[model samples]
Every structure is written in structure tokens, then in C-alpha cells.
Target: MSDHELRKAAHDLDVTVWVGKGGIDPVVDEASDQLKERDLIKVKFLRAARAGTSVEALTEELAERTNATVIETRGNTGVLHR
Candidate 1:
């Protein structure tokens, strides 16, 4: 899909995965699983997870770890797709 279409689709998606103090390590499997079950999944990076990191950094890392692509990062939330 095009970037515009993906962004529009992501607008209605709720955050299905949350990265907290435990960070991306714990959510890697869960996010990957969610992606396998659906075309798109949204993730929120809480303040604890963002300590010394930016949302773009965290989401990019998570996407790499989960073998997904970051559709976008808005505020502390990110949309991911495989």
C-alpha cells in the first residue's frame, strides 16, 4: 500500500502492544505474533521505555527485531507491518 493509505489505515488502529520499562526485548515475540495475525499493529512506547531514547529509535529497533517495518511513528506510538 502507499504511505498515505497506510497512514490512514493506522489512524483507526488501537495500540495493540505496549513497551514499558521492560522495553522491546519482551515485546519482540508478542509484536511479531500480532503482526503474523494481522496486517498492521500499533505499539505505544511508554515513558519508562523511552528513557534516554526517542520513539523513532525504539520503534525502529523493535521493527528490526521483530522483522517488521515501521509504517509510522506519531508521538509515542508507532504502526508496524510485515
Candidate 2:
């Protein structure tokens, strides 16, 4: 998705975003449940900046780990599939 799309989604659905690392499993589990009901999830990454992980790698890693579709990246903000 493009920045415009991301912004529209954020504005339309009232997305919730946050930062964390090494806790992707539980997060995905809970998010999966939420997705079943609502179909959207957005998680902003902070670990990559703090821990020196490349944004592309971090996005790929998280997408692989969570089996989520990477919907968009606008700067450091990442939008994920539900």
C-alpha cells in the first residue's frame, strides 16, 4: 500500500500501532484473533532503529514470523496484514 492508502486506512479504521520485539508470536496470535473479527493490524517498528536491524529485513522477518502480508511502509512506519 502507498502512504496515501495507509493514511486512509488509519483514518478509516482507527488503527492501533506500537513498538516491541521478540514478542511477535503472542502479538500475532492476539492480532489474528482480532483480524478474524476486524481484518486490519498495523505495528510500528522501533527495535530496528534501536537494535540496528534494517527496516527491510525487520519487515521481512516480522512478516515471515507472523505469516502476515506487508501491506505498506511509509518511512519507518509499517503496515501489516491481519
Candidate 3:
């Protein structure tokens, strides 16, 4: 799908993964596993996980680790696609 289509598709997706104080480390495996089962997944970065980092940065790092692309990020939520 195109970026616009991905964004539109992500609009209705419920957050399936959450990053908290533990940050991305704890969720990398889960995100990768989910990507294996689905084309896209939504992730929410809690306030604790945002400390000293922007959602874009966090999303990039998580995507890199999971071998996924960042479909989009709104507020603290991000959508990822493999």
C-alpha cells in the first residue's frame, strides 16, 4: 500500500503493543513477532517511554529492531508495517 493508504488503514487500528518505562527493549521481540502474523500493527508509547525521546525517534528505533517500517505516528501512537 501507498503511504497515504497505510496511514488511512492505520487510522482505525487499535494499539496492540505498548512501550512504557522499559522503553523499546522489552517490546522489540513482541513487535517483530506481531509483524510476522500481520502486515501492520499499532504501538502506543506511554509518557514514561517518551522521556528524553521523541515519538519519531522511538518509532524509528523500534522499526529498525523489528525490521518494519513506520507507517505513521500521531501523538504517542505509531503504526508499523513489515
Top-scoring candidate (lDDT): 3
- Model 2 backbone overlap count: 0
Task: List candidate 2 stretches off by more than 4 Å.
Answer: 1-17, 21-26, 47-50
Every candidate's lDDT: 0.94, 0.58, 0.95
23-80: candidate 3 lDDT, tens digit per residue: 9999999999999999999999999999999999999999999999998989999999
Off by over 4 Å in 1: none
Range of the 10 consecutive residues with the lowest summed lDDT in candidate 2 = 10-19
Candidate 1: lDDT over CA atoms?
A: 0.94
Report the error of model 1 at residue 29, Å: 0.4
Candidate 2: C-alpha RMSD after superposition: 3.7
For candidate 1, list the clashing residue pairs, or say none. Answer: none
Q: Rank the candidates by TM-score, best first.
A: 3, 1, 2
User: What tens digits encode model 1's per-residue C-alpha lDDT throughout 1-82?
Assistant: 9878988999999999999999999999999999999989999999999999999999999999988999999999999989
> Between prediction 1 and prediction 2, which has the larger lDDT?
1
Using TM-score as the yardstick, the better of models 2 and 3 is: 3
Error of 2 at 61 (Å): 2.0
Q: In candidate 1, how many Å is residue 61 off?
A: 0.3
TM-score of each: 0.97, 0.58, 0.97
What shift in Å separates residue 27 of candidate 3 from its native position after superposition? Answer: 0.3
